[model samples]
Target: MKKLVLFVTMFIMVLPVRADEGMWFLMFIERLNHRDMQKMGLQLTAEEIYSINNHSLKDAIVQFDGGCTAEIVSKDGLVLTNHHCGYDAIAELSTPEANYLKNGFWAASRKDELKPKSLYVRFFVRMDDVSKRILSKVNDKMTEAEREKAINEEIALIEKENNEGGKYTVSVRSFFQGNEYYYFVYQDYTDVRLVGTPPESIGKFGGDTDNWEWPRHTGDFSMFRVYADKDGNPAEYSPENVPLKPKHYLPVSLNGVQENDFAMILGYPGRTNRWMPSGGIEQNVKYAYPAWVESSKLGMDKMKVHMDKNDKVRLDYASQYAGVANYWKNRQGMIDALTKHKTAATKAKAEAEFNKWANKPGNKEKYGNVIATLNNYYSKTNEKARHDNYLVGLLRTSAFAALPYSMGRGLDAYASADDAARQQILPQLQAAIDEYYGNLYEPLEKDVLAAQLKLYATKSTGYKIAPYVAKIGAEYNNDFKAFVDKAFETSIFTTKERLGEFILHPSLEVLKADPLYLLSNDLIAQYRAKSDEQAELDAEFSRAFRLLVQGMREANPDAKYYPDANSTLRLTYGKVRSLPKDKRNDAKVNYYTTMKGEVAKYKPNDEEFDLPKKLLEMYEKKDFGRYADKDGYMPVNFLTDNDITGGNSGSPVLNGKGELIGIAFDGNIEAMAGDVIFDKDLQRTINVDIRYVLWIIDKFSGAKHIVDEMTIVK
Candidate 1:
């Protein structure tokens, strides 16, 4: 079969990498990587890095906003994370008259800190390997469904037993394709407040144009303070709450860095698919990612128009727009880099080798069919994945549909409730509807829905396309614009006033007759119809993947193996290094970018390149301050060979002494495919130098009081 050859080619061409590459678990650092890390300049003991019984580096890091990593910088719980990590909270606190997102925000004092309705930081309490306990319940003889159920049940029981009567949050995660399992315990603090942030010009400088590019100049950092009850225990936000006094915090290092300087990062890296097969990579590059890129660009285009026109809309949509635009560019890079590297072909060759090992007489029953099975399934479902992407993208852009879909559940509850219950719930429903309308803008939603609906009707097929969308298209003679016109003109969901009037006297009959409500239900139904089939296929793929990886590890027992990232705390270490250039690309890159370089990129009034007047004045005067490196130039950003992925944003980049020197924000463009395959020669971790963060705080923002809290060292 053609699939067999592709897999064969992929396996044969796979190359081994030598540069530092891994997101290693903390518990195994001593036995597995401490020696190698020391050879590369690690000065701390493995226990010093992640000891459970004593204060260590692990105590300083927290998972920020359930996604990114952040580090405590002061005894009073001041936390440092990437600017984009806190963008959503900043946007939430902004107003048209005093837009924090546009002008930036500073607390000035602890008393002035602004707390959001919901924001939390989680501390890493401990982690334990539970592979034997979990695998004791699962075996190769069981069917995929049975294996999954057994593992889930074992994980649930282990998690429940370890929670300590609901005092701490617990989770069990699989690593190395379920060959290993670990349980993590966490303590969550809810009363977190915004401390400060730079203006969009400084924080998000270079925007999409320089998002994942090198020679970077973005500040890309923000500050927040965690709070607790007077006794220093985690509690809900209240006026009586006080700043938390954490067990450990990182001291800022101003010693500066040079090429080959030791660098390490501690953070929660979200996810990586380094072990995925050639078939999977081919599908993502050829089918799935292209659709995602197109739809995301469409959504970003629509949002930018409305955001540029209105200040209020800009503040509300700033976070949403950045999030969409980030992935839009990332997906395009993935496609380009994967194709250029011949990634799929390389992976197929590797699969060929795996097949030979898997088909051995002793291993035939356990692993023989995994490659063939995965290839066959990928072939059959490639188009469906593309269709699903369009459908998901359409819903993402249709913001109005969310209100009806979400509120419809509330209304359904009301319809089924007794008279007493209705009296109790009506006011809550009213408040919900009011809040929804507060953020909704009819014209924006109408335009977005029109674009998405047109794309869906023309490009999608089978049960994937919502039936209501099809009906509207047919009625309007395939003119989605005209159909949108009618829907906006007559739909109750379009106007707050109309929706409010209906909400005053809620009933199931009125909702059933409403076009938007009916459409919401139809989309939900269509999405659910595909869920069961997808889950079945996913189970098959997961089981095959587990067997394949397990077998490979056995066949090559001497090889060094690290788990793929899964939003769990991990450590990666390497040295500051410049990327080696090739014939296809020869852009000269330095190990660091300076303030002069940042000013050089400036274009007055340009959204992505503009700098503050004060920044320019300071730069012109050469206000190097004490934070400047010995060369008399202030470092803005630098490069490292550290392996990292998405969730590693805002992670602390530390030196051998475990002192914070920079914050990892982005990765090099050539290494965009690093998530799927670690490239030794090309991959680099992009970091904002700690000196820049302190300069912005002390000189640019004039917030030295906050700076005084950090233990800065020369």
Candidate 2:
């Protein structure tokens, strides 16, 4: 423990902090960043940002639906997050007769708010380092598996210790490639309900064509309210619950932004690999991401064919379609940006320099083979990486491909249960079957699965392919439609009714002989299959990676570093910034965009670029309310240099006063390689200005009551 503290102190003393390059830990704000942040125009003290004993800015932020960030905006628990973040919930609550996703909906009063089947928001309570305690349980002499087992045992105790007898949710997360550990405490409220949203035409204005691009105009915000019992403690959904009065809420700032003004973002950033080696980068850019892009596109194309022709089917698959399209574009962008910037070569050069230091006297025994092990592992797994990504596409997009694993496991358990146990599990299995069939549109699912199977079987030739799929593909002349069609026609798992009949007389032999189940089982087995040699290599690779990160820190004691993001609460600060002048951006400067540019992209009846009639009329009339800038234009979106990534969506983009100025939504296309490396000059966080969010809610949607709930700062 003493040694660990000394090493941490040495690391801090040598860090030459870069203002715009790190996702900082809130707990270390005072010791590591407060002074630097103040120099960059922060007005509040570090204690005001994160305080365990008092209500602070950290109290306002939440992990929305366990994926994206959100913030409390009102004393009544009005929560704000990105439209796409709330997309699944909104779609779930919508129907053809009352399509809230298409026409938008605002709760006229508290009783009018709509609740989805499953939704929750988690507030971060605090975090503390548990590294020394965890690491003390393992040593260098232990194998990786032994080390992992020991760590897991300790982690379970740590979580139990902090959970306060089930009142709080606790997670022990590893950082710096498992060199360090921290436990986060959070409280979750399950009775969250949708408050309001704009029409799809406005909420998703630019859609796919404009995603991850600058000079954008998308009102990408959604509102929900958290409810709790009268005592303000977490509880399940019930009509007796009321709006939660939160510990803190951010005041919406209408002061707007200009270039160089101070801006910061706080959120749970998902993941990044800034310390990844050159070989790993090469594998992703050259092999894995390309397969992911191609397979995702194939699935999207097949689904869209049916979605375009039927409204019910479109509604059923809306959320799934959006998720696939977003990643498809993102992965392709990553490939382009990483290749264009030669990120792999850059990492390789750095590795060469580190290798020299690694082989030196005292370091030779501990770190000499680290680089070789990593390189050899990546080289050997390159083809498998590509193969796995293609299969990942199938599992993500095709329900049937994953069903045999997800549902079959449940059935296997049920079949093995005794009579008394079966009575308890029968109802739960029925509900699961019902839910699965409820969301599925058979024609769309069939088409997508067939197309993806064909694509995967043909493109995954570099490694061992799924035997069942391969055999069926060859029998069908590499076309899987007829085979998939026949399987769907005969498989009991294809429909709720057939599955219900099977539940009455469960049989393991029937499940094993099922065509669809056989195909799905083979695909899953192939993906998980690993030779003994390969398994050993993987374990060595993990150990070597951890050592490489630790060795680099020791070698370059003067360099600055932050742990890579792993879905933990982080803060990043910078300035309202712009990119190099481009003909594409219609803004006067590239720092911010206006309503005029959004209207310019509008098409009368197009899906992606369509605009509502009321929005058009308001834009033409120049009926800009107080939400407009002093120059008489409605600010739509703005740019900032705050380092962010995927899970940062819906994060509060706050001004120096800790007031909400905008909501972080996307990153620029030029910096899509940001997960691997940070580019201070080109990387920008795209935010929908807070004023635009208010205007849509109060003026366009007539939800003035919602605005009244917030403390608006002008």
Candidate 3:
């Protein structure tokens, strides 16, 4: 019940997410992939990740901060997405007595459908190339730090002054390391509501058992409806939040998946970093994430002990509990995969080849041990950085933390250091905090910020915090400072306190003189600057990747050197596969699940299994119709490891023929390293095949009318 309420509260608050494509741009480098573009295979001269300004497909791409992606599968506001993507909604609309996790939610009628008070989805209306304008001030001579800032400021200014209006999702992204920028205009709908979900047995069936493994039988799909005001304007939730009348929507596919059938996932993939040195890779294999899993497991166990004793703490911490459980399970899987398997060894071999070539020429001195240096950095930083959060969060308050969050980068707006093109973004950046701040948590969020800084002090600087701590007392917003004690006389305390004090109360003269702070200027400047820097680093990394790719080409010219994901609408083709961890653990992998499994996992022969008795009879019949598998069985969905992360949720998995295959949800635990590398051999995408979803609509809920609208391919 608490999970339901918490999800409801978060449902209303929306979030933002990025990708790329062009001709002169495509032809610019006359290369398959360029740093100017993010998709080039390894060992190529391509610069960095960039959007294709002239591609139709690029413009058609959209992102939602709602933890999922959807495509217009119909003329109405009906959206096609993954089941796990809609988990929170399903939970919110569920009742403890009904426990949607055990059964599932199926709106008997449009009016009866469960409505999530604040559910929403973003539609991509258009994308604008604001690059030339963004980089007008930059040059080859500037320092890396300086260049990064200039590029950022420029992009922010562009987004601020001119926007696509509030009806849609909007964001600006920098690509190719200060080489380019683009603004995405998205149509946002507030009328999104729950449409369907498989019982947890099917949707998330297998629970922790099959996550991140192959030969998996996890049904991972869900459905929702989008509503709009009668006037076709974006509005808050209301009886007025009518069903959305959409321009486009994806259809539910009933076609079956076969071995080696071409498949591609189209959605907002979270992230990928294929440029880290072998050293960093080794850290992940050794202590970094492994230790993290252990620590998280310990904390979660402790939390559970406390939770079992007290219900309020459980309710307050349920979200945290769920989160920690999820992370612990997933991270453990990843750690096991890295250590037990040869994925890291594969990367090490590739780096060694690059080292050989680098040594043959003067380049060897420049790039030879780059991998080692990176690994060294990883080894040195991981332990301290991973554990620093506890210190930071436990000691500081949000207001105190904001000071460092702002200026931690440098002097001057990073983007302002460069060009007029970059300057164009200043106004846009200036308005960002005001635009997005309302969507963020300010106090509980402070805990995370404090934790980050606390860790940084102890880990990097070896500086201890003053025992004299401060917090935002309930009475005065965040003005309460317990730091008014003598213990802060220590050097480290004095240094940190001085910085904090200045930030909280900058010279009134400086504060007033600054045009940025009058508004949410600080946040605006920070994002803009960081965004640009991110682009620059990615672009540089692309170059390094090319060097690595070259070695691969030399080693196996026939093998495909897949490019890093750049949030662009790209396709990855793979088949449903599995991992045989051990004899006893060899698991069942499938496309969908059943309530029976959920009952077995939890209530077996118990009162909970009777949810079906209360449900409509039509749902009791296993008539899965055309959406059923070839085995004459109903399926909910299946998961794959096609190298995806956060943003990939709700992404449509398509076949090689460009047909929808499944909805991408997550990467199996063995695939978390996907953030920095794509393990072609093991990275899988969690997908809910459309056929299983159709079964829920046609057979389970007698909602054939909903499925009728889709252009089901097979």
Candidate 4:
């Protein structure tokens, strides 16, 4: 009777409410979403979207570099993704003399393609529910630790069973706050090569100023090709490897989008905490994000100082600086939007209702304390959360702060090894050490580390601080420049030559005594330290939160529900839509932006908004060719109601007939709170229209052969 009630409750809860407000699993679309999608103009069947034994849309989508999404656009594995998604690889291949990032590069033929040392694209093969099998191993009486162990044992077996003798990678992911489980299988191709990109002025057009804001005119797309062995199996970089023959590739559409025209996006969205409680929301908005914003700005300011003076320094720190700036802006936006929306108060009201439902006679045992547990956990950890985020900022921006932890482990292994083992490890260790220093610009690094250390030490005052940092703070009065200078001068890890000598005569004593290593160890230990009582409370809180979700589903029987995103493939459908008219946008209609608006933002020789002379000349001459919209303007970027987040950076936005229309990249600033709560009115996905991508490749870059490889449908 109880099980039947739970089933009926879940069925009612999952009934569609808002059409544009979910990141839905592909596996559940047929039962839960297909009818609504069809009504909204999805011409493709659910089977056509995902099929294990057939060539389908799922075959074309891949997790790019384990972080972002990309799609195979040609039969020979020409992959399309956003420029920022390919930023690291592009930066790796760039040099001061022949800088591809400053001036875009297009491979004339397959022979000219450049490969990065480490880059991979993973194709999703299949997925299936394993909830029943895993859940059978745990019971209500079991502790969270025991429950975790039991589930992990089953997960390992399931992964091993499905791996098919090492041919595929398998992952068992928990969903619905551990209420369910599913296993995903994937195949990874490691030999992805860069084919083309726009110059930074176009690829990153508006830079930090225009990021996450609509009226966006950034041409934020890049191209790469996946290579495989002769049999079409994944392989490492080899001269003889050929472009992969993909199972399915999207047909690019020449027909432009109009308002209310049905649209959909598919990608691996990284994460969303839509199920997070009010206390957690309050903690992040009030405490954690503020620290993140401040620390990130500190790092960016210090890096930019040296980066502006030297081309080599700029090249070395470009990727890092861009990364820090993006999140710096994003966190501050979240703080503002959350505050503006009063998201915490809204969540609290809902929780108040849930608390009443939970305390009712029949529900008291399972859910009565769930809300209290969550509230207690958040309140206890608020200050620590702030402290941790500050530390996280340091870890992200300072190479030396993390280097001891990363490289010192190898040194420890060498110290303990026999003579033969030491010989085997020495070359690999030496190569890694050399690679570390090769990319590092020491003077800029010192400035960044000093600035970040000072910020972290001075600002992270709410709780116990890292002991070494505290000592340094007291000695230097919270300014770290002199200490960082002295440490850099004395630390063996500072240079490749010193590290090489230390490796020859490895000693645990020397590593322990090194000031840099000691500092790194102390920082890490402080972050991880927790009392036994706190650990118990955390465990109880985890169990209570999962029950809270389950109980909420039962209590709200008619409310809509979907699992939070966990870096898995999902499909979200909506339409090409517009918001209320705003003067910030140059578009007469708010749905799209054109080249004229982009050109208007340009400044002469400016880093963020500069335009190439050729581009400006072409725009002035009205030379967009066939890529222009029906209105005779060259569309740069467009807005849609499709749902997206961080990992959806390069997702393909498809029209009703499953034809590629645009590449989904950014989200509007007004809806920065979308991750915590979906706002149907304000949330919009900002995308670079496919036509703009083709215009740059065909007419501007003269890479017509590359465009010719695609399956274009008018």
Instruction: Work out the TM-score per prediction.
Output: 0.95, 0.97, 0.63, 0.97
lDDT of 4 at 145: 90
lDDT of 4 at 558: 62
lDDT over C-alpha atoms for residue 550 of model 3: 44
Q: Rate the local accuracy (lDDT) of all candidates.
A: 0.85, 0.91, 0.50, 0.90
Q: Write the per-residue lDDT of candidate 4 for residues 242-322, one digit (tens) a residue.
A: 999999999999999999999999999999888888899999998899999988998898889899999988988899999
Give per-residue CA lDDT, model 3, range 518-547, as digits (tens): 212332332233335445544455444434
Per residue, candidate 1 scores C-alpha lDDT tens digits across 78-183 of: 9999999999999989999878887898898888999987789999999999999999998778887898799999999989998998988999998888889999
Winner on lDDT (2 vs 3):
2
lDDT: worst 10-residue window of model 1: 580-589
By lDDT, rank the candidates, best first: 2, 4, 1, 3
Q: Please say which candidate is ahead in TM-score: 3 or 4.
A: 4
Q: Tell me the number of clashing residue pairs for each predicted model.
A: 9, 0, 84, 0
Model 4 lDDT, full chain set: 0.90
